[model samples]
Target chain A: MALDRKIAYINLSTGEIRKGDIPLEWRKKFIGGRGLDAYLLYTNNPPGIDAFDPENRVLISAGIVVGALASASARTHIMSKSPLTNFLGSANMGGWFAPEMRWAGFDHLVISGKAEKPVYLWIHNGEIEIRDAKNIWGENIYDTQTILRQELNDNEIQTLCIGPAGENLVRFANVMTGRKNAGGRTGMGAVLGSKNLKAVVCRGTMDIKIKYPEEALKYNEELINQIISSKVSQTMQRWGTMFIYGTTNSTGLVRTRNFQLNQLVGGSDIECENLDKVSIGLDGCFGCQVHCRHRYVIKDGPYAGTYAQGPEYTSQGAFGAEVGCNNMNTILVGNHLVNSYGLDTLETGSMMAWAMELYEKGILTDRDTDGLRLEWGDDEAVLELIKKIATREGIGDILADGPLRAAKKIGKGSETYLVHVKGMSNLHSDERPTPSLALGIATASRGSDHLRSRPAIDLYNLPVQVLEKVYRQPDGYDGPLTSGYTKYEGKPRIVLWQELCYMAVDCTGMCKYHTVFLSPNHPNFPEFAKMIYYNTGLEFTPKEIWDIANRCYTIERLFNIREGLTRKDDWLVDRYFDEPTKRGLPVAYNKKMDRKKFKAMIDEYYSLHKWDNDGVPTPELLKDLDIADLYPEESRQERKGK
Target chain B: MKIKKVMEGARDGEIRCLACFTRFRPKRGVDRAACPSCGVQWRISWPYPKTARLQGPVWETYPKPGEPIAKK
Candidate 1:
């Protein structure tokens, strides 16, 4: 009834394994998945440890509600020190792997120490074994899955693996499962590769015993009915995330040529209609009713034999519009190539787009690119460069490290075009249009991530009463497009509410698309509390959930504070605050944020969270959350050796 | 786990290989077969699945999944 789950702590260097019950105290404070992961990673790893060091830990956590009857509950969180940012790094993915791990009787798997050689972990039922991966060491994700399925003789086995990009230490490498699900941010795969770990294959058939099963089922039925009837879910189920392409382009959110332009020239060619040309059918995650993934087949274009599961709106923004490529089929190809190599699509495309801009400006040459023409919309060049980057071949060695690192290596004002925050490449969204979106990216712990706190509903231009009621602000601010009320009053509250909701949703294993991400009418805090209550029999109010989320976020803030990030780190790139969008209508173009107002907004945000003016969680607030033990004053004194 | 078809009634149709993205007309029905070009095995059958010229998996939208074959 209390959710019986164990955590597996495996030391790869010593070939040792440890198992223990999750501390109830920790569970009460940091629910599970991303929340618990942040707590464990911050506590287990000190501030100045190298991301590649043997002491750096990797954590895989199944969500608190994973494997339950709830739709899209089959999600997992991956956490480690990111090689890209050298700070607290985390990502989440949806697939069957988390459910398999849940069935295997573990909610968290903590891995430490680098193995002597390449190795893979095999978990069957409750048994864990470390096995040699000599034969599958250099394989791609798809091939590795095929081989492991054959060798294990269990086609049903679920796997989480890294590909050659990770094995080669591409700083933006991602961990992948099934054919399409990827924990694709902050370089979790590179950490796995640094530990000489190849894959974790698991199979389990045990039943998950939960409290109030009937109540959970009833909630699931209600949610399914609601999700099916919702207009946003209906659109998502049909067009996946690509449904937003036209709107994003119209609103000056479709980033092109490394954020130099926010609108694509040939819009219709990169819209969902173009994606529809290749989308053969729909595919859903483990139990997702929205079915936002599309199974695409390239039957007629230059990339006519490509097949893959997605090209989510991110792919459209990354490969299609951003690279100046008008053909959606090429975007599908780029998606397939990136997935095969287990690279982060956003980072890869951003890097390529950055390099193309440099080449176009004569900052980089053919000699620098290993004689390959680095031009915009060159699909063949894009394909070849992807391979080179994955294998770290030729000039690809520099690009493999991501745009930030590559810019430093080729520093002749190339850093001027570097579209990143805190050494991580920017997402496809153009945040300059909205202060809330811009601030969200600036303060996200993982750096330059939108999922951390993108208040997707703020873009809907909802009625002020609805906004005021949901965000609890005094008034509905003027829309994000206007630089009036949104910049002054309500943005801080919107971002704060969004971050907590997203953190809770991530921990609870619910897809944000099913929540208030797309619209104000979707599920919210009370509904989440109800779901948790029915599933785990844990009596929690919406306020308690918000408190736990605050504690989790505070832990992350403490981690980043110790790593030397300050209020100065909580700002956007100069392009957003300096240069205006190159071309668009007068109302939507030549837009730049007021840096003074942004700073004031940050102050308000910090004050609301009881954080100091410097964005540090205060001792009084930590004590209020009962987590002061995590960051005693002596820790800072000890850092100074005083 | 792989899909376990009850096999109440087998129908003849074209099927595409997810592995190789090849579409072919199987001499024996589309329930299970191998791609002629890429040699990848496929067991999932679609509802009247058709490819662009059957040369290879080009960029084209095939028919949507049938109601019975849609659920996983």
Candidate 2:
């Protein structure tokens, strides 16, 4: 079957549809999904546009590789001007929705303008219609999904819906897909709400074109087998990502009590062994073999018989350790509640943790919390707060803006307890001991995150110097590369290399956990790359792949710099600098991060990239990437002025 | 009789073995042969003083499922 590339453009004001074929050159260079979204956002100059502006477009693009013979694990990217950072923001999510979009004969859907009334888009095999969503506008995410499925009379038709939080335009509202998978950053759901779009329901039967089915099938099968055999995969398969809970806690990187402490008293309660007690079976994305996703049931609690798809390691730490709640049942129920309501677990957990700290210190009381005592380790209180946050009821209204904004509103030394870096809450990963990882967290564009860089693996497994040397070496090193598991000197370089590699994985529509580090071990990556080449006819050597990755990463950095981001914005929380763990702990918390040394490292990083002192892309560098025309003129003035 | 002999050898200096369960010990060498009962190989660097050990059960112990285990 021939695949037609259909681009769906919705005008919010007129309810008119504009359909066009994806440009041939655009598809060739950008591929699809994240790559295409990045190209489109860059071309549109969505950066610096007010996130709520009608002109600000949110494009949901599915990769060309998705719904094909290739791994259907390919994602859908939500690209928009972020209300959270007021800069370029894109968050990708994996579920049935992306494949359904492909089956609907669309490569991407570009949504622009604001609808005058609440509405939902229904696309079934190329026919599109916008229906009034007045009845389901204020529903929770679960209810909205249920109602949409009933209304469409198709339970299998995958839906992406926003909750009351999104409908209320909460700055951190996440676009929830499937049951628990979410594009959970930069408030893409709020942008959807701004357009008065309640949900996107897609169902279709069209087959995606495959260039080489036999080779693709062979490569995919081999890849799955290799994953099943890997030791890391075995561990993940057993306990999902929660397998790392005990190890991360032992490594002193688990975010605890709102990043105040590196250790938790109840850390053992949520360990892999303990999680196995509550978990029923493994859950995974469509066509995923790793099955790292998990489903857990809370058999006993104030909220009993609650089952959730995940309280994945991040959620576990955020709800369990960060808030000082040790109860597995609480974490499970909390995960179910948040996932059902379609709230970002990271934000909900971090904000609730922050609230608990304020309550503990008597900064917040029953009066502030509307008669509910917010105490640390109180699972009941935590559950109440999660519900409130979702419904924007009581204390939830205050926390809907997230920790930084909530702290500002509730200021009376409340800001001191807030543990965000650059307006985004710290993820479950703590960055106290590993300075390289700390720097990565501090410098992450979307805020404090583990995914932007993979320095955590080094902290957990390798020494610093060896990681650095390996990074300094090119894509494929033949020398005695440092064991990434051992601590050595040259770590910053390794982190930089990993960051570039991650950029490629994200753009190419591959799962990072499976593709990047394990590539060397797997026999299928080379064949997988060959499959891409066969499909797109873009022959890319591994070196060329790295170059493309570097180009994408540099462009992302340039995008931020255009919006006036500086090295000063790249910084960790004060707790990392000042707090010291009690004696006998692995965390050497009292040691102050040498700002001068970190600045020197940044200088080295800039020089290594041939960028200017202020981290702007040089004219020569842009020309080398053949993206000279893509560099905005305003950025040129900003770079020249700097 | 063979198991007893192996245990006796492990306890005596003739064996020069470390506790195989905790591999961090011995501080130097390791025995090529594993324990007959546990299949754990003892490191050679550790001095096995005959009178110094055996206060508890020899097998590895862990918390059973749903049982509350002591925190690390």
Q: Which candidate has the top score in lDDT?
A: 1
CA-lDDT, candidates in order: 0.77, 0.67
Candidate 2, residues A319-418, lDDT tens digits: the string is 7888888877777888887777767788788888889888889998899999998877888888989888877888888898776778888989998877
State the weakest 10-residue window (summed lDDT) of model 2 chain A. A582-591
What candidate 1 gets wrong by more than 4 Å, as runs, is A300-303, A473-488, A636-642, B1-72
Tens digit of lDDT per residue, candidate 1, span A1-642?
Answer: 447778999999999999889887777888898999988988888567888998999999988888887768878889988899887789888879998988888889999999999999998787899999989999998999999999999899999999999999999999999878899998999999999999999898777777888888878777776665554565566677776664556445668877778777545566664556678888887777767788988776566776788878888877877788877767788888888999998988888888889999999999898799988788778778888888999878999987678888999999898888888888877777678888888888888888888887776555666776677622233433222323455687788888888888888877777677876767777888888888888777888888898889888888888877768788877788898765432334557778898898798789878998778888899999999998898865664463
lDDT of 2 at B72: 24
Q: What lDDT would candidate 2 get against the real structure? A: 0.67
TM-scores for candidates 1 onward, in order: 0.87, 0.85
